[model samples]
Target: MAKAFASQGDLAEKKVSFTEVGRDLWAFTAEGDPNTGVIIGDDSVMVVDAQATPRLAGKVIENIRTVTDKPIKHVVLSHYHAVRVLGASAYGASEIVMSEKARSMVAERGQEDWDSEFGRFPRLFQGHESIPGLTWPTLTFNDRLTLYLGKRRVDLMFLGRAHTAGDIVAHVPDENVMFTGDIVEYHSACYCGDGHFTDWPATLEAIRCFDLAAIAPGRGDALVGEKLVNEALDNTADFVRSTYRPVARVAQGGGSLKEAWDACRTVCDPKFSNYAIYEHCLPFNVARAYDESLGIDTPRIWTAERDLQMWEALQG
Candidate 1:
């Protein structure tokens, strides 16, 4: 019998966590699921990443209301993934900020990604109907954009291309807190389907240059203290290297895609097998690594059909 396509079978509800990472920074994590960063300023709040759907985001809003009645002033995206940005409408923030490149990716393949991801992971879309449509950024920045939440200053920096062409990190200078969307995952697998392998390490280096007291990653528990924070960054860097290096080597040798996939798994699985989404992401990650190793810089659209085709071809 054929295997189920991608993450279709991963419908179990994950345990959610809301923990304080900084003075007023909160991380909403779901057992290695996609996380939401909460930054409370003097007068208002800033949400780092929107959840999957409006109903999902409502839960985050409920938590935000617990501490502060202050309105959420801005919603910032770390990258252009549908699971991260589609629930943006629920925030009602004055500005939805994203990197200019992310906005372009959304325009090019947002609808297709929505369709593809909703099918792959149903738990994140419990209230899929509540999503208004594709989320568009009302404000976009080329390299960096700075915003002040009263006294606190938030710097959104595009630390080169890693997870996507438009990956940005939100750095809170005073508190030494950085919300690195998908660019840095703790124990969770780095979802590299839309990633830039060769550029990821350089981006990670740029992130390391910051003196981070705490890090709220896209998934996994909030990393606090210098030791754990360094571990998370190192782990993320290791994951990207483990997959891309083996796959790139295979691709460079003119090996088949299946060979690239197997070679990558051989190198990565021993260490990352237990990470969240490891199995679901292997095919797409390997596919991207193979193409990028061959010089395909711009990512190809991943439709539901292509997702299943690649999954079957690699894992069947």
Candidate 2:
């Protein structure tokens, strides 16, 4: 291979930050690693997006203890990705919640994604053996589900698809703060391997329509205040559009996948070269963009073997 595959070379631990985005709402961010949201209510607590493994999730629990000793009654999965859902058991929450489509994706491609991601990013899955099989939601909802942690209200809604087919967001109406799971990244690369390019912008617009005061994004720092939130939204939309347009143009014109990759790099690198995980996400993003342009609506399942095959073809 031309370079270390994905984030295998990134072994150094990142500086973890627990920032309060809104009243009693905390965001656990580790540089550009996947983030977890903590919503403390009048009684119990609700967690969003469990980390990659039990050991990693323990860190979030430790942070949670610093603030309030309230029990974590619910764990909400933003999507069905292994990195986001495998650490669910660590929470020990009575109710594990996910959108119906997300649970279906788990039934469809969960293990394959687990194998693929564990191989791609070893740093994220520090305690892989502790994952205790695939994480399944005890509770599933179709479009929207409202849960109350005492007086605090959390609205978990499926606001179209962007990063994945079953992507969802947790909105706290009282705080005007949203915990957007991979849907809105802040200065971080969007993992579009399972994404829908055409549907991404519209999904982003739907979040924008809310005019949120704060957002705990899937990765990077927590976005507090309306201006920072809007910036992240605009930048994320730009990243998705920029990656897709050039690759789509190349593919529609009968260009090779390599050609499409080069075209996407030309457009995306200058603008997003400094973004977190930019390199790790590029080839897959380009390949998916090519496939989407060729009229593939659903993203192809990524297995460990397929990841290597695609990486060798693009990076070798």
Steric collisions counted per model: 0, 0
TM-score per model over all chains: 0.98, 0.99
Runs of candidate 2 exceeding 4 Å displacement: none
| Candidate 1 residue-wise lDDT, 1-316, digit = tens | 7666667778788888889998999999998889999999998999999989988899899988888899998999998888999899998999999999999999999999999998888888888988999999999999989999999999999988888889999999888999999999988899899999889988888888886899999989999988988899899999999999999899999999999998998899899999998888889999999999999988888998998889889978
lDDT of 2 at 95: 98
By TM-score, the best candidate is: 2
lDDT of each: 0.91, 0.95
Model 1 scores worst on lDDT over the 10 consecutive residues at 1-10
Tens digits of per-residue lDDT for model 2, 1-316: 3978989889999999999999999999999999999999999999999999999999999999999999999999999999999999998899999999999999999999999999988999987888899999999998999999999999999999899988999999998999999999988999999999999999999999999999999999999988999999999999999999999999999999999999998999899989999989998999899999999999999999999999988877
Clashing pairs in 1: none
Q: Give the TM-score comparing model 1 with the true structure, all chains together.
A: 0.98
Q: List runs of model 1 lying over 4 Å from the truth.
A: none
Best by lDDT: 2
